[model samples]
Target: MKPQTRFNRRDFLQTATAATAAGVFIGTSSASHAQDSPNERPVFATIGLRNQGWTITDKSTKFADFAAFADVDANVLGMINEKLEKKTGKKAEGYKDYREVLDRKDIDAVMIAAPDHWHTKISVEAMLAGKDVYCEKPLTLTIDEGKLIEKIVKQTGRVFQVGTMQRTENQHRFLKAIALIREGRIGEIRKVTCGINGATGSPVIPAIDPPEGLDWDMWLGPAPKVPYRAGTEMRRGYGGGVPLHTNCHYAWRNWYETSGGQMNDWGAHHVDIATWALDASETGPNKVTPVSYSLPVEYKDGYPTVSDQYNSPTKFEIHVNMPGDIPMIITSEGDNGILFEGTKGRFFVNRGRLAGKPIEDLETNPLPEDAVEKVYGGAVSENHTANFIEGMRSREQPISDVWTHNRMLETCHLANIAIRLGRELNWDPTKREIIGDDEANSFLSRESRKGYEINM
Candidate 1:
C-alpha cells in the first residue's frame, strides 16, 4: 500500500532542538521523552540480517521491539531469528525478501543493514511505505542516491538515522573529542588525518554454485548480477565463520560493486567525525585528489575490468581540499583513528580512546561542565537506537541527519572516483557537481539494473 505523505519534516527537526533549548525536560533522564503521556516504544523490523544487522538489532532491543527480520540468505535468516528470540524473547518473523517487511503496517521503523548497493533502494522504499529508517552507512552507493534520499525523507516526514553510530555511541569517546574541539582546546584548526585503514585485497576466488537456501538474485538487488565466488580461505574471529574470500559474505567489503571497501566502510565513521569537527557538515571540499593508492585489479573508465577478484583499492591516501582551506587526508597508513593538528594543540580519537596534549590538559584547563552534552545536543542516549527512538517520539531527525552525512560522504565517493580515474577532481559543492569534468560527473550516479529500480 502507498503510504500517506506529510511535509512536516522541517517542524520535526525543529521540535527536537527547539524544545531542548527551551528546557522542556525532554531527555533529562536517558529514557525520557517530551510528552507527558509517552507513546509505546516503536516497533522495529530489521532487513539484511547479516553481521551488522544483528548487531544493531541487539543494541536496539532496549528501545524498540522486533517484529520481523528479512534477509536473502535463508541460513542466516534462520540463525538470526533464533538468536533474536533468545535475546528478546520475541519470535520475529523471518523472510527472504525484504519487501514483505516494509509492507507490514505493524512495524514502525526499519533498521537496514543491507549490502551497500541495496542501502538507498531499501531506505527510500521503507520511507515511502510509512516506516522510519535507520540505515547502515555509508548510506548511498553514489552521490545522486544521497540526494534522492534527502528528497524522499523530507517528502515523507519520517525520522531517518544513518548507522554512523560514532555520532552517538562509541563509549562517548568521539563525543568528548568533538567537545574538546568545540571548547577550543585545540586552538585554530589546521589539518586533519583520518586513518581509516585500507581494504583487504583478494586472491582469485573460484566461482561456485549458489549456497543452499540463499536467494542470490535478491541479495544482488540493484547491483549487476555476477557469479557467487568463495574459496577455502577462512576468515576467523569475525562475522561468525563466513568465508574470508567469498564475494557474497564479509569479503563483499573488498568489492566496488557491493561496497566502497575501506574508503566508505571505515571512512564513513572517521571522516564523519573529521567533517563534524571541521564544521563542514553543511558544505564540502572543492577538490579531491588521489594522492596515492593501489587497486588489486585493472579498471577501464572507472569500472573494474575483471570479476572473481577484489577490485577496490587495497591501499589509499586521499587528499581533500576542505572548506576554509583545511587540508584533510583520508589515508590507510597510521593508527586507526582521527588525528587533529591545530595551531595550539592536537588530539587523536577513535572508538577506543581519545588522546593528545589537549586531552591531557583537561585536568587544569577543563571545558564547560556540559561540554559533551552540548556537542551532542543533549544528554547522550544509551545507544544510537535510543537516539533514533527519541527522534521518533519527538518527530525529529536523528543526530546523523541525511544532509550532513551526504556532505561528508561526497569526499569518500569523490576519492573513490578520483582513484578509479587516476586523477584529481574539481568539485562545485554549491552546485553539487564535478567542475568542467563531464566524465567525472557521470560517476556521481549509477544505473541500477532493470526491474530493481527504487520505488518512489
Candidate 2:
C-alpha cells in the first residue's frame, strides 16, 4: 500500500504550531512524571559495534539508552564500552555474541552494523524476537536474502528501517536534483549514469594464529572459513589498527564477497535516488543488461594477483529497462555523482553541488506543488532516523521502508550478478530467479555454515 496522505503545507504549518504549544504544556506537566517513569527512555542494544555502529548509537542517544553492546571482537567491544560510559555517564552491559543481546526482553530495538553477510540473519532473528531493527544499507547480502527480509518484516509487523540516510538529509543536493527531475524541471529522464569505480582483491599475507581475546570462528559467521592472515586485519579496521586495515575498512567498496563492489555501495545511494525520483519504488527495471566491463587480467601486492588484487570490475556499464519508454544506463564514471539526461537539458548532482547547462532554470521554475508533495508525501520530518522512530510509534511504514529498499537492492544485486556472470541475464522479479540459468540462480544465495540457515 502507498503511504497515507495527511495534510497540505498550510494545514501542516498550523497543526505544527498548535502541536508545539501543546507539547510545551505536556512537557511542563510530564517533567515530574518522566522522573518516575522507568520506561520513558527506550532501551536499545547495538550489534557489531564497529565503524558505523558507533555513529548509529550516537544518533539514537536522544531516543534511547545504550543498554547493551555486542561484538565478536573483544578489543572493539571494550572500546565501545568505554565510549558508551563516557557519553551516557552510565555503564552498558556487554556481550560477545549478538544472540545474547537479542534474548533480552527489555531491549526494545537493535542497531545492526555487521558485515554484509550477517545483515539478514541478525535482522531476521531480531524481528522474530519482537525487536525493532535499524540495519545498514544494501540491506542484504544477496537477492534471496533481500526477499526473505521483506517477507519477515511484513509478517512480524515490526518497524524495519534501512540506513539510507540520503533520504534524511534535507539539504542533500543529489535528492534535490531528483525532485527537480520528478518536477519535470529536467523533463523526462531518458538515461542516468552512476559511477562506482573499482573492485576488491585478496590481501597477500602469510596465515597466522588467531589473536588473543578474538573469536575467529564467530567473526567468520556464515561465510566460508579461511585461515587467519595479515589480510584478516583488513576485516575489522575500526580499532585504530595499521594502515592495511584502514584501506580495507574505507575501501570495502571494492570487494565482491564483502560488498557489492561499487555497484551496490555507491549504486545503492545514487541508483536509489534515481528510482525514487522516477517514482518506481514498487517496481523496478524488468531487464538488467551488462553492456561491457573491464577486470584486472594479475595480482599486485595484496591486490588481485591475477593482474590487480581487486576481483570486482574496475569499469563496467549496465542498462536497466524500466517500464514504459524510460530507460537508464548506470555506469562507473563521471566522478561519483548522478547525471540525468533529459529532453530539456542534462544535469549532474553529487553531495554538495548541482550543475548543468541550464541550472538557472530550476531557480525560476519551482517544482510543481503536486510533484513536491509526491516526493515528500506530506511528511514533516526529513531525518531518516526520526522517520524510523515515528514509524515505530505510529506503526507506519518508514520513508526507506524495507519493501521499497528491497526493490532497489534487487537492481543493485542484479548488476553485480550480471557482471560476475559476464553475460546479460534475464530476471523474473516476481519469481526472484534468473531465467533458465541454473548457475546464475545458484549464486542467489550462498551456502551458510551448518548452523546459519534462515528457515523463513
Candidate 3:
C-alpha cells in the first residue's frame, strides 16, 4: 500500500478512517515503533494513573495495547495495571517513575495525565525520548513552559496532541459552533463569554503525613515543596474518595503552586473553544483585566500571605481585550458554557447543549452537511484519542496543536496574573510579555525546583 502521504486532505481522511475501521497496520515502519501484527494496533503506555489517566488509556485500548503504566502513587500504579489486565486480558508492567515508561523502546506513544506541574517535564522528556505524546491540558504550568514544549515539538518532529477534547469531542457541538461562525450564520463576532466555574476557597486544614505507598516528594515534582494537608471532608464525584482539600489528587487544582485553579482548569477547555470560534487561536488578547475578583488568601507582593487555605480566586470576572476589538469575557458566574454574541445572532454551547436563534434558524436555512468537517479541517475523528491515533499514523499534528493552545491559554494565564497582582495588565502579544509591569512579567515563568527541573 502507498504511504498515505499522497492523499489530499479529503482523500487522506477517508483512507485513514477506513483503514482504522478495518484494523489495518500503517504509519511509521513497524521497526520504528512497537506494533502488534495480528491486531495491527500501536503499543501504548500511560503516565499518571489517576482519574483522567485511566480514562484516556481505557478509551485508547480500542486502538492500542497498554504496555506500561506509571504513577507516583504505588497503590494507583499497581491498581491501574491490574485493572488493565482484567479489562483487556493483557498483562502490563507498572512503575513509580514516568522515566521508566519513556525508557521503554517498545512503547510508541505515551498518554500523560499528570498534574499540571509535572506536565511539561514529563512531556519534554517523553518527546526527547522519541515518543509521540497525548498530554492533558493546560499543558504547561507557566507561559515559558508552553513555549518550551512548542520548541521541543518542532525540534523533535514528534506528533503531539493536547487533550482539549472539546475541539474534537462533545458530540461535535463545539465544532458546529465554530462552523456557524465560519459559515456566517452569526455575522461578525462582537463578544464571547466563557462561563467556566470559579475555584472554591479551601478551609485551612492541619498538615498531615503523606498517604501510604505514595512518594510525596516525587509527586511534588517541579512545584514548591509543601506539607500535605487534608480536610476532613472527602470528595464524592469524578475524583472522589480523596480528601477535598489536599495538596494532591482532586484538590491539586486549588493551589497556584501546582495548578492554575479554575482559570487554567476549566478555562483551558471553554476559553479554548471560544478562541477557536472567534478565529483567534493564533493570536492572543492585547490585555487581561480583573474586572472583579476575590482571592481566598491575602497577597503580599503577589505571593500568598497565608498558606493554609486556598490562594486561587474563589470568584472572578475577567475582561480580556482580544484582537478585532472583541471583548472576550471570562466569568466564574453564569451557566458553565460559552455564549457567542455576534452582529447577526447569538448562541450558547456547552457539553450538554447548543442552543440559540441561529441554531433554530438552521431548520429553515440549514448549514451544509459538511459544516462540522470543514470546521475540523477535514473528516472529524470519532473522538479526541482517535484524532491522536490518526496523527500518529499520518505523522501530522492533531486537532489541538500545542502552538494554538498556548496562544489562547496566554489569556487564561494572564487573567490569573492580573488577579494575583490586583491590576489590569497591558500585554504585547507579539512579544508575548506584559507590556510595562515588571512585577507581572515575573509571573510569566517559574523556576523549577533543582531536582525537578526539565531535562531540556
Off by over 4 Å in 3: 1-39
Better TM-score candidate (1, 2): 1
**lDDT for each residue of candidate 1 in 323-379, tens digit (9 for 90 to 100):** 899999999999999999988989899888888888789889888888888888778
Per-residue lDDT tens digits for candidate 2, residues 1-456, read: 124221222233244346445653111111112122434766778998777888888787877778899988788789888888888898678899898887887777788987777889999888877777899888887888887776676555566778988776636565567667766776777777776555534554455666677687776677666554445453343544623421233443455556677787778887887777666776777788999877643433223443224466777888987656477778875577777888888888777678886567757865565554456555435466666666666445567777778777788888878777677778776676888989778778877877766534
Q: Higher lDDT: candidate 1 or 2?
A: 1
For all predictions, the C-alpha RMSD in Å is: 5.7, 7.6, 5.3
The 0-to-1 C-alpha lDDT of every candidate, in the order given, reads 0.84, 0.69, 0.85
Name the lDDT value of residue 305 in candidate 3.
Answer: 90
- Rank ordering of all candidates by lDDT, starting from the highest: 3, 1, 2
User: Which residue pairs in model 1 clash with each other?
Assistant: none
Clashes of each: 0, 17, 0
